[model samples]
Target: MKDGLKQRLVAQARAEGFDACRLCRPWDVRHVPERLAAFLARGYHGQMGWLEERSQWRGAPEVLWPQARTVIMLGESYTPECDPLAGLEQKTSGNISVYARNRDYHDTVKKRLKRLARWLIDAAGGEVKVFVDTAPVPEKPLGQAAGLGWQGKHTNLVSRELGSWFFLGSVFTTLDIETDPAEVDHCGSCRACLDICPTKAFPAPYQLDARRCISYLTIEHKGPVAEELRPGLGNRIYGCDDCLAVCPWNKFAVAAREVKYHARADLVVPKLADLAGLDDAAFRERFSGSPIKRIGRDRFLRNVLYAIGNSGEGALCHVAQAHCEDADAAVADAARWAVLRLRRDANGLE
Candidate 1:
């Protein structure tokens, strides 16, 4: 009966548009506490202090819900039809991460996880709880234990069939679903992801130092990006995908089938000058339902100014100069820095 129910759940997950579905015992991830501790001890999480606050519960899923006998892990692919790295070559344009280019995945993935959890509970007469990235759960490790994928050297889950261009969600349930065998690390002898990082965020093959991660600096880090590191960020406005894009396993990957996951044409390569003009209200209106809205206007503009500075286009000097007097100190500082960069580019100075 448990095997039959597990099979039904997998089929339903596929029918609902998830790329893959797998099950594992909730206690399967209990062994991850040591690595979790190591990561936290090294302060690799950067300003995401929440990782430290929730470390105890995050490393052990069973602690999160003592009654959960099984965990259903699902993966949703968000691969774009075209290479996401293409915009990086265009210095005047900003490259937004493919994940943030569409409607936020939290809403889309959560709704699906909730619907699936409800269905499982109703069909199997058990209790369940669903979670997306917002939860304290260590999703990547859990995904690994559930056989969805192995934790790649980039520290993101990578599947043999789906590659790394996927989002994960979990459903903890009291149902006794049969477990799938965990996937083995297939990244042996491959350091492509580690070497591809523009900011050199990876300190070791499988370890990431978020402080140096462009994604963290551009999106998560609240203060001024270190002056030395800003150049490596290039024009990436939000999250960095260089590591994911360079993974060889992605060759077999398919573009996202869900229309909601499709990249917005305007977001693909937004003009830095146009983005720098947005105020808080304008930013909210433009990014409504998009992940970029979470960072709010000031931080978003700070990123835009960084891109403008790197653009090396004197034509963008006016935009940078305008933001130099922005009310937000961070934006103003970034704008001032951009003006200097533009000036230096134009007149070959120290």
Candidate 2:
């Protein structure tokens, strides 16, 4: 009976736009506690204090909700239609991460998760709870346990079918659904993802030091970035995709079917001059439905100024100069740094 229900659940998930759906027991990710401990002990999470604060719940799904018998992990592909790395060469344009170039995944994925959860409760007579990235749930580990994909060397879920470009969502239910076998690492002898990282975020294969990760630095980080790492940020203003785009597995990556995940024309490779000029109101209005809005104008401008600093275009130096006295300390710091770099470059000094 549960098997039939699981089959229908997978079908319903596909109908609702999920690229992959598989089930696993809530306790399937038994290694999470120790791994989470090691990561936190090393201070790899950076400014994401929530990860440390909710360590117990994040490491143990069973402990998070003891009543959950099955965890249905779903993957929604958001693969870029064009080369994600191409924008890096256009130094005058800011390279927004492919994921943030469109609608916010949190809203889009959660709506699907909620609909799937409601269907499960109606069909199987079980209480259900759903989560996207906002939750403390170890969605990637659960995705691996459910055979949705293996956590590749870059520490992001990579599937044989969907490759490296997908979002994870999960539905935890009281129903005792049969589980899928976990995926094993297929990344043997491949270091493509690690080799491409501009900031060298990976401390070793299969482990990430989020402190050096551009994604964490650009998005989660609150203040001015370390001077040494600023150069590695290059023209990446929002989030970096060097590791993900370099994955060989992405050769087989599934194209995102949802229009919402497609990159907007203006956001694909926006000019640094245009972005550096946006004030609070303009920034919010421009990024209304984008994940970039979460970072707010100050942080966003900080990133843009960093990009402007890296941009060798001396014409943009004045844009940085304009923000040198920004109300936000981080923005002012970034602006000063940008102006200094551009001045040094203009004078042919290192």
Best by the lDDT measure:
2
Kindly report which residue stretches of model 1 are placed more than 4 angstroms away from their true locations once superposed.
none
Clashing pairs in 1: none
Across 104-188, the per-residue lDDT of candidate 2 in tens digits comes to 9999999999999898888878799999988889999999999999999999999999989999999998889888999999999
> In candidate 2, how many Å is residue 2 off?
4.7
TM per prediction: 0.98, 0.99
TM-score of 2: 0.99
Q: lDDT tens digits, residues 1-350, model 1?
A: 44488778888898888989988887887668899789889999889999889887888889889999988999999988888889999999999998999899999999999888888877788898999998888788888888899999999999988998999999998878788999889998999999888888998988999999988998899978889888888999999999999999998786798898998888989988889888789999999999999999999999989999998999999999998888888889999999999999999876
Which ten contiguous residues of candidate 1 have the minimum total lDDT? Answer: 1-10
Q: Model 1 misses residue 188 by how many Å?
A: 1.8
* Model 2: residues with Cα > 4 Å off, grouped in runs: none
lDDT of each: 0.89, 0.93
